[model samples]
Target chain A: MDSVRALTLIVTMAFLVLAMPAEVALGHGVELSVAPHESIEVNAAYEAGEPMAGAQVAVFAPGEPAEPWLRGSVDEEGRFFFVPDSDRPGTWEVQVRQAGHGGIVRIEVEPAGVVEVTGGGLTPLQKALMAACVLWGSIGTALYFKRRAV
Target chain B: MIGIRTTRMVVLLVTLLAGILTFAGCAAEGAPEPETPAPAAETSDTGLLVFAADGEEHAREGTVSKEGWNITFEHAYVTLADIAAYQTDPPYDVDADGWDLAYDHMVSLPGEFTIDLADPASDPAILGEVADAPAGFYNAFSWHMVRAASGPAEGNSIVFIGTAEKDGETVDFTLRFDQELAYQGGEYIGDVRKGILDAGGEAEAEMTFHFDHFFGRADKDADDPLNTDALGFDPLAALATDGVVDVSLGDLKESLSAEDYARLEDILVHFGHIGENHCIAEPLE
Candidate 1:
């Protein structure tokens, strides 16, 4: 009875395996496309596609392969966008990796040439001043003109 | 006269001040800075739209046009190894069912280019209407389908990739798939059955049909010029990756001339779809 039972189990296992289609899991998928010149700020990352989150980005100049030109983390949108050439020139390759993960994506970075972030990020005070100038100037001029008309 | 001039000056100054304030407030709202000959960057309005069907992202389109149909397909279950770039896996795995799909389209949201539907017979329901897409999302409101033809109808599915610009501005563009057949139920297919039946009820077992995606200068750099063989986009070529796709396209491809085939293929190759796994079928009947 034991021998017969064992045979039955083996056959069932074989059959099930045969009936099942090959299941291939997708690895990390990355695409390389030229972002518009203005939206060139970007980051390249690599990670095992599973967890679907928490990947870090490291960009390096292609061929140089030593130190990364830029490094950062994948945002909530799984993206890391920085000025492509923070004002420098060289073919770059951005790679993203996360801790406790395996999967590396290497993408080509054509020379974006150069870019300089001249404007400091908006400061609250500066913003307020610009607003006041436009608002108050217009209001004051309008009042003065109205009074004259009257 | 001098007093009147002084008063007029006062009024103009007041108007200028008010206008400045209102405009400044708007500026404070953080509208995109006007284009200032941005340094040689890819493009700010430029972005990446990934069409993932089956289990992989086989094709990557860098840009899309707003005036015409932008399609993407992820041939999963179907044996489609010969279809596009990177024939790295078996065409289809029948055992594992999937959310695999064949196409995705992202028409520009704030489509501003006016298009003249040369065909008066186009479905009037969606004609000549400007679309308002929310910022940060594709907005040319659309409807898509993918139906089954063998035994019973299967539900087709579609999703908007993202919106983009047609020109620097807004306009209406219409395309029709009638005069041949329509693909609405997810408009996805996995076989060339249509081609077999078309070959005099013994169709060529290959699917063929015209595919169109109008382009501006930018799209030409992104699309497969080979698909636009006639270059002028004459009678478009019908293609088949499976017998079912062929069966569905009917004789529409035959309607196109060799010159037309040449023209379309020329333009399509620029967008990636090139070579034999994807072909311009001889109008066999």
Candidate 2:
């Protein structure tokens, strides 16, 4: 009877595992969902065609209509996260990629805003001045040497 | 003819003597010597800081402050040595006297609209944060609000801040100072790190040890002096070597007091970078 009960428990455990859907276990193949925490989830795994286990993920936050924030790689399953906790808010982005799988996603966080400041980096005139000075110095040195030789 | 030959021989001997003297002088000149100043204070502004760090490698020309660092860049790099405002011995022994309230850290640059955005009256976006910038900031003259050491933002006011621009970016970076001496429940982002409170009955204040990077790390190198608490680093070696750039002290001093000056000075001395200097080959507005 004890051996029968043990056998019954093992069979029941195997049956329960088989009963659960792949979505619950492996997540319907790495789809995305938005949660109330202002976060996006990407259920991930070792995708087909390649191992897809340990790929590096780098996130470049969306520039427009978004807050610039970055987060990479979820847990062992392959999901990642990005939370807009800063006072500066806008559209935020989270990107996840590993080995040979995954992709990028864009999310918009609202209300708290940012001032987009745009200006010339290094002006052409400044670069020109520096170049001209070096050029003039070279020319002057050549001229000085010519005169001294004479 | 005898007189002529005598003059020629005498002239020859004199010339030989002079030539020997010149050669000896050259040898003396080649010996190692200390730096000599330009008679007119070096009007030749290289716009670089080759000599810094106690004037050992470079002589500082511009006034370096939170607003900007101006150096006579005869060379390619600036050597900035850390300067400390206060020094105290180990453990809380009564023998250990507190740092005197000299207020060594002072900074005042010329800018018009001063705002305590940390104040409820105004709420300016922390522009520096979005820029992936350091924790400190400076208000452009006539643009952002400059914090007042005495007036509205005195002691515990929060406002919009930023420095100038150089190399296509803002010069005023933020120093994530912990102002425990001046605010309730700590008016700083100390939740990420440890800090100390200045004793002043009720009017307390605090400071972040060095410039806080975007990833929330202090710039102090591994050998940073502060421990885990009382304004220290986690690993202590990551003190940032990159200092603020762009604004000059003389320009900043245009609107600062002795106290404000000292406070700014002290803060930079502890947390500023050595290789920091600013240059805008671009047109100045």
Candidate 3:
């Protein structure tokens, strides 16, 4: 009886191995899928317009400003591209450094896929004040010149 | 005719005033709302945020200068004041905004600190720490390198007492700079990220000084931009008397060549940094 049971078990194990798929047996199979993603491309250059080739790049995601969410180096053209996680929708910072010079650029990404680059330009109030000053100065200068001519 | 001219002038003034008021109103309406103050962190959630000053390995364990003078420092003293850190919503950009930093929360280490960067006891000499700092990423930093009132760096913003040797010649040097400078920098950029304070944890924001910028690196090529821009020890070594070179910024300006003096001034302006990230330094008024 023991001999019969051992022969049966051996036959079952052989059948299972023979029934396994060739790809599963070899274990070299791969799967692929394609999808669209929103990516940001940064071009870093010096004041002289020289490309910062091979410059180190660090990307900081929204709310996690201290750590680099992704790190890479720019290509020969001083360009680096990365697809940020859509789930983290806020201001994304990209820092580029080469040799001893570096700069940081901030991009605002909305949940709805709207992207905008924020700048440090003058505020509207500041612009208004500047314009007011210019106009007042012009007027004052014209009045002064008119009085002098008189 | 005179009455008519007066009336016209009054009308013109009224029109200008009205236009100015209209522009101001429009601008006020379009301006961004000021950020609300960040909510106070829970006592258990708050953490310590340490501020430190680092002169890099060049200050701690000295290396050869661009001119091939092997230099080692005995003391590199820098006096710092008004050191503050911020958690900016849209991280500050030093290049774009200059020193204008906007933040939701800020922690300041109030007081003057004189630190020796070359001291082997602490690689980065700790300036101070805010024990209950809010738990967040302090991304922007600013500080002033002011002349120390009293200490090893008294009467000077920076004082480097070191030795330089090359080609069988050695000089003991003491270089002092009196120019008061203010530096504003963004996030720390290096092999390790910094300024992230977690709940019940500690974090650090570093004020890094690149001494290599002052005495160029011999490891780098002579034609490298850093080496080319640096005012190497050779210039100071040339001014040594009996193997001792001690000078202040004023002394160097009067003794060294005009070109070398200018390079020295330029190096001081670009000395302050956040790790590898550069800061905009302006002479403090």
Question: Of the candidates shown, which would achieve the greatest lDDT relative to the real structure?
Answer: 3
Instruction: Give the CAPRI class of candidate 3.
Output: incorrect
Question: In lDDT terms, how accurate is model 2?
Answer: 0.26
What is candidate 3's lDDT per residue for A29-138, written digit by digit as tens? 56333343445556666554556779888888988766789999989987787777878898877777766566666666665443455432223453454445434534
lDDT of each: 0.27, 0.26, 0.77
Instruction: Indicate whether candidate 1 or candidate 3 has the larger lDDT.
Output: 3
Per-residue lDDT of model 2, residues B1-285, tens digit only: 999999999999999999999878877889556468757643332111011012111122222222222222221111111111111111111111112223222122222222222222211111111111111211010011112345433432121133323344433432322121110011111111111212211111122212221112122222222111112111111222353422234433443455544544343332322111111111111
* Tens-digit per-residue lDDT, B171-210, candidate 1: 2211222111111111112211011111111111121122
Using TM-score as the measure, the top candidate is: 3
Give the deviation of candidate 1 from the true structure as CA RMSD: 28.1
DockQ of 3: 0.13
Clashing pairs in 3: none
Candidate ranking under DockQ, highest first, comes to 3, 1, 2
Chain B TM-score, all predictions listed: 0.21, 0.17, 0.84
